[model samples]
Target: MLLLTCPWCGPRDETEYHYGGQAHVAYPANPAELSDEEWAEYLFFRDNPKGPFAERWVHSTGCRRWFNVVRDTVTYEVLAVYGPHDPRPELAAGDPR
Candidate 1:
């Protein structure tokens, strides 16, 4: 089972959280000016990287707060956890921290 740490509640089972998809996705600056294609891209497109990726998760069963996590997609290893407003951490390649 995967283990995830909530920024507000500390470590807990992954089952207690809800995946919020790719992190740092900003909403379009001018929604009304965007074409259908652009709107669709903003809503659906996300990076699917092979290694460590920044993602959003909500601790539904605990604090019910949203946070970001740097996790390895292939190994299912969580590297870092931070609040939603915090900046994404810079992780070195091959570093297993």
Candidate 2:
């Protein structure tokens, strides 16, 4: 089983958490001014990268707090774990998104 380290509760099984999809997605500044396509894009579109990606996760069974994780999609290896408000860290020279 995969293990995720929660910012508040430390390491826990992946089952103890909830995946919140891609992180760092910004809300539209003017929702009312958006066209149908724009609204749909904002709601459903997300990056599906093959390598390291930033994602949001919530520790449901533990502290029940949200946090961010930079993980490798192909290997399922977590590169970094950080708070929700923290900026994404710089990956190593060989790491790619």
Write candidate 2's Cα lDDT for 2-97 as tens digits. Answer: 899888888899999999999999999999999999999999999999989999999998888999999999999999999998899997787643
Residue lDDT tens for model 1, 28-74: 88899999999999999999998789999999989999999998898
Error of 2 at 58 (Å): 0.3
Question: In TM-score terms, which candidate is top?
Answer: 2
lDDT of 2: 0.92
Give candidate 1 regions above 4 Å deviation.
93-97
Q: How much is 28 displaced in model 1, in angstroms?
A: 0.8
Stretches > 4 Å off in candidate 2 = none
User: So what's the TM-score on candidate 1?
Assistant: 0.92
lDDT of 1: 0.89
